[model samples]
Target: MSLLLEREDATLEIVDDSVLTICGEADFDSAGPLAQAGRHWLAEQPAQTEVSFDLTGVQIASSAVLSVLLVWVRSVQRHSLRLNRVSLSPALQRLMDITELAPLLPAVETTCAEPARDRR
Candidate 1:
């Protein structure tokens, strides 16, 4: 929707600290690739690694996304890995809340961090 600016259908990025960011829509058309990729990443996390799912840029989140998230949870448990955390935009947070799925995953409030200033 507006968050996508209709420019990006979906995007997947793995940033620093192994944060997996899923941008744009997390719908039927977009969930497959994400799930496939996510499974790969999740399989590798355990024994002192942290992985977070950053859905802050997602515009539309549907059952498809929710299902994928559920799969992630199962993966975490399956691998006995500690999920780092989940970061959600207000919209995504509300979507999870509406579906009563927020409690299923350990998510923290997505607050802006102060920019690091150069001390030169």
Candidate 2:
């Protein structure tokens, strides 16, 4: 049997009002770390703070990663915190469209300047 390995490179920046900008690869195996960091940041913030996910650097996101994102959104909603300013790659946007989850998440700006081929 062969083992599979997944790697994720992500950076988290805490903006005002507890909005955290997440940039980097959010893949199947890396979703856990990303979610953990997000949750940790939320816990550190005061009540009624928003957490914005910036996907400018995200190259690829698998279904698992999307699921993680949904879960995080739900958690934030439950806490009465707001979620805004989510960016996604074209591939991810397509996936969201296919799954009809785009309406649930915040509207994404389609200004990602990175080439599709360059993203991975």
Best by lDDT: 1
| lDDT by residue for model 2 (2-118), tens | 112224465555545444455567676677777777666665656666556555556675786678667767777767776656666676777777898877775333233343333
* Candidate 1, residue 98: lDDT: 87
Q: Tens digit of lDDT per residue, candidate 1, span 31-54?
A: 777777777777876654666776
Query: How many pairs in model 1 have backbone atoms within 3 A of each other, for residues 3 or more apart or on separate chains, i.e. clashes?
Result: 0
Worst lDDT window (10 residues) for model 2? 1-10
Q: Candidate 2 has which clashing residue pairs, if any?
A: none
Task: Give stretches of model 1 more than 4 Å off.
Answer: 1-8, 107-120
What are the lDDT figures for the candidates, one per model? 0.66, 0.60
Q: Roughly what TM-score does model 2 have, to 2 decimal places?
A: 0.69
Q: Judged by TM-score, which candidate is best? A: 1
Candidate 2 error regions (>4 Å): 1-8, 15-17, 106-120
lDDT of 2: 0.60
Relative to the unseen true structure, what is the Cα RMSD of model 1?
A: 7.1
Question: By TM-score, how accurate is candidate 1?
Answer: 0.75
